[model samples]
Target: MADPTTPPEPNESVSETEIEAPRSRRRGILVAAVVAVVLIGLGVWWHSTYSEDTDDAQVNGHLIQVSSRIAGHVAKVYVDENQLVKAGDPIVDLDPSDYQVAVENAEAALASAKANAAAARVNVPIITINTGSNLRSADADVTGARATVAQAEEQLDAAKARVEQAEANNVKAQSDLERYKPLVEKDVISKQQFDAAVAAAASSKAALADSRASEQAAEDAIRVARERETQAQAMQKYAQTAPQQIAAQDAKAKQAEAQVEQAQAQLDQAKLNLGYTKIVAPADGIVTRKSVEIDQNVSSGQNLMTLVSLQDLWITANFKETQLRRMQAGQAVVVHIDSTGKDYSGRITQIGGATGSVLSLFPPENATGNYVKVVQRVPVRVDFTNLAKEDPNHQLRPGLSVEPKVRVK
Candidate 1:
């Protein structure tokens, strides 16, 4: 072999132009590197103009509190701390005996009211029937009385004429008897004729007395009929109050119906209270901060536990006032979750009306003599656009640190 570590032999045909070929290749490489740097610089400048990013952000979501709606002694606690539960799931069971008793009482009261209403309604028909019968009977009595009076008046007139005729006949018969007596004494007439005349005169006198008695009876009958008519008229006036009596019964029915309605409302309220004895979850969430236990006496609206929702969440980014110049709602954003080392696509959904400082418990007053101007940060809410794809397992929670980048252009 040739000498070890010796240079290889060169060809004689190679010239300066060929030798400068390597330099030219190196020069091209330098130019390419410079071009790449310039391109990268332009790209960074362009991205800076359109992209607004901030690390002052946090994952935010709803933190619901579980409370008791009714006062009762807890019979059982179904959920513990950090237990996941679905909506309408029972969290606690209170003793429902008292509420059940109230419901039963309400139902009994409603039944009683309805029964009273039915009874009142029944009275209306009965009063109407009785009153109507009284009116009809009274009207018939008045008609009958008037007819009797008319018949009595006609009889009285006939009797008076008969009495006058009887009196005239009696007077004629007496005159004939007296004349016969004188003629008999003078033997001008027979004795039998005089006796006949005397008998006729006595019969006429008896007929006249009977006619007068008949006339008196007719007058008494008329007076009796008139008295009956007056009584019937008075009875008719009393019967005319039938409609008013029916109206009074109707009023009683209405009052009973109103009571029934009131009782129905009470029953509904009792049912609601009974339902409250079972404390059910208002929404799907993870239970935490459990402050209630079995047999605990809880009041209405008292906090029993805390519920945190993990399914729906968003990033709250507090961007500087200067950085919010081109920020707006509905703009695309990128959210970076450091806890999971995940990047998710998002969009700006809301912008706070006031700065964080202004929303604090004690806001700053710039009118103080000794004041220093400070930049304020505004809260921007960014919601996930591809929520399911990025956080399918719901790993994000409220108060978690996150980085959000909002696109300005």
Candidate 2:
């Protein structure tokens, strides 16, 4: 053996260039790997610095509950589950026969009330005219009766004067007759003179009787005139109530008008009830959770269906509290829907006022001194900016999972 520790002799086929080629190839691969890693690190840092992403997001929309406003037996159901409907489209129909009858009855009542009011109004003027005429006539009668009583009083005074004159003449004639009787007994004068005295006395007595009769007749006339005056006064007292009667009539007319108004109100209410029998859609949406059926008896405010409005939809993203440092309203957002594998453009509308755990039914209490820190999530509302353009078919529904990315920078 030549030297045990010495190297063996080199072969001529293995050149020095071949030995150096392995080292050069290894160096090229190592340099390329280092460059690739550096580029990837820079790209990741840029993404993290400029944007925020969260998978705790979902699509949300308005879920309107459709119900009956009045109690009735359902006669028709116009929509099925998942059916699209426009605002004011008929959704259900209740039996309208009862409402129709109510409307008819109300109309009849209103007509009756109107007729009564008309009659009462006509009576108002008539009563006023009649009462005014009666009052005027009574006043005229009272005046006339007073004049007749005055005339009767004057006649009574003249009759008394005539009675007094007649009595005086009768006394004088009787004295003369007594003197003639004495002369005739003594035969000192002619009998004709005594006879003349007797005739004068008789005539005077008859005149006195006639005067007394006239006085009695005058008293009777005065009594009759006074009675007429009393009658006239009574008539005036009755006519004095004419104004009160007219007012009462007017009041009756007003009451009738009030009744007419009440009837009109009732008729309007009946018409409204009739309109309520036809249930219509409140907005444009897709019907779901249909619980009403034909011939089913539904009470007032009973749930008939649920209407999901896809036209007004948004995303609710639960973001970590740490991610909200650079987030704010009106920031641009990209929503990736997991169900549809589609991306929608939106903008941040609002951020929650409190964390999800604090808003929960049972919030955690850390005051017991055994506190463990937790990462809390805050709800963020993102409203689509291009919903009409991207989702024309309205396929995005509520409660769909989504991933949202916000460009915070």
Candidate 3:
């Protein structure tokens, strides 16, 4: 104010503290900037040390393919595409008429086989008893015939002795007659003595003839007894075969029983085939890719539909090799599903054995002369914990992108 555009005189009463105030303020600002930078660096390092996150993750679930077990014409289709179905629910039906008829045929065969078996079994005991009785009767007949033969032989011997004695008496009587005849001729003996000697010879001759007849009868009796003994032996032999015949009958019965069993097994198989006509869901899932329809002729092992199990879902997190240095199984994970915009708690269950590129259908070969270095990604399976309670409707499915953060510490 004293002079315009003229330099003013410096004030000497101002303290050094006041003079250095601006520098102090600048120094304070610089210190604050440095401290802030250090705190930010620490926060970033801590976050990196405790957690690893990746957006290259997807929800994975079981994909089941449903097929027909037998060949048949479809009668009904019960499910459509994307239909929710429970385990053991009837999903399709095939023509069961043929199988039912087969079952009926098998049952009829089984009944017939059982009847045959029963008849065979009944024959076993009856034949056994008849054969056993025949054997006993034949044995008794043989014993009786043996006794008769022995008695006849003794009678024959006694008759032979009697004949010899009669012959000897006849010879003596004849000799006496000859002597008497000579005496009569000589007039030294009476005619009466000669007549008596002749009568005695005739009587001895008759007795000899009778003994001869008795001997012949005894021989005939012996022959008859021997014939009877042979016949009895034949009968006894026939009786001895009863056990073999019984064994044969038992074998027949067993064969019939085996046939019955075979028929029953066929019946059971037919019933199983009939039951197979009704196709049921193997598990709880959402149906998809359903190619079956009503009145379609499907063959065995034909794919009928596909089912996706939304329950028990997991996230397949593909992390870069560098990021996997801090990842491991049993670590806590936070999964955020992009579809539902929801967060789910999970834990790492397993790490893939091979990298994504190595597991690819066309794996890269480094020896191809134009090889380029590239980072590889490894898949880690993260299974949801309490998935049902978190999302009761089973909203998660396979192939849906998700973000997962794994707390390695």
Model number with the top lDDT: 2
What order do you get sorting by TM-score, best first? 3, 2, 1
Give the total clashing residue pairs for model 1: 0
Question: Model 3 reaches what TM-score against the true structure?
Answer: 0.73
Model 3: per-residue Cα lDDT at residue 138: 95
What is the per-residue lDDT of model 1 for residues 1-409, given as tens digits with 9 covering 90 to 100? Answer: 7886755555434666688999999999999999999999999998898989989999988889989999999999999899988888999999999999999999999999999999998988998999999999988888988898899899999989998998899889888888888898898887888788889988888988998899899899889988988998898888888898889888998999999999999999999999999988888789989999998999999999999987788889999999988999999998889999989999999999999999999998877599777899999999999888878777887898999988899
On lDDT, the stronger of 2 and 3 is: 2
Ranking by lDDT: 2, 3, 1
TM-score for all models, in order of appearance: 0.69, 0.70, 0.73
**Model 3: per-residue Cα lDDT over 2-65, one tens digit each:** 7666554454335556779999999999999999999999999987889889898898888989
Of models 2 and 3, which has the larger TM-score?
Answer: 3
- Separate clash counts for every candidate: 0, 0, 0
Off by over 4 Å in 2: 1-43, 120-142, 145-261, 363-369
Cα distance off (Å), candidate 1, residue 232 = 6.0
- Residue 202: error of model 2 in Å? 13
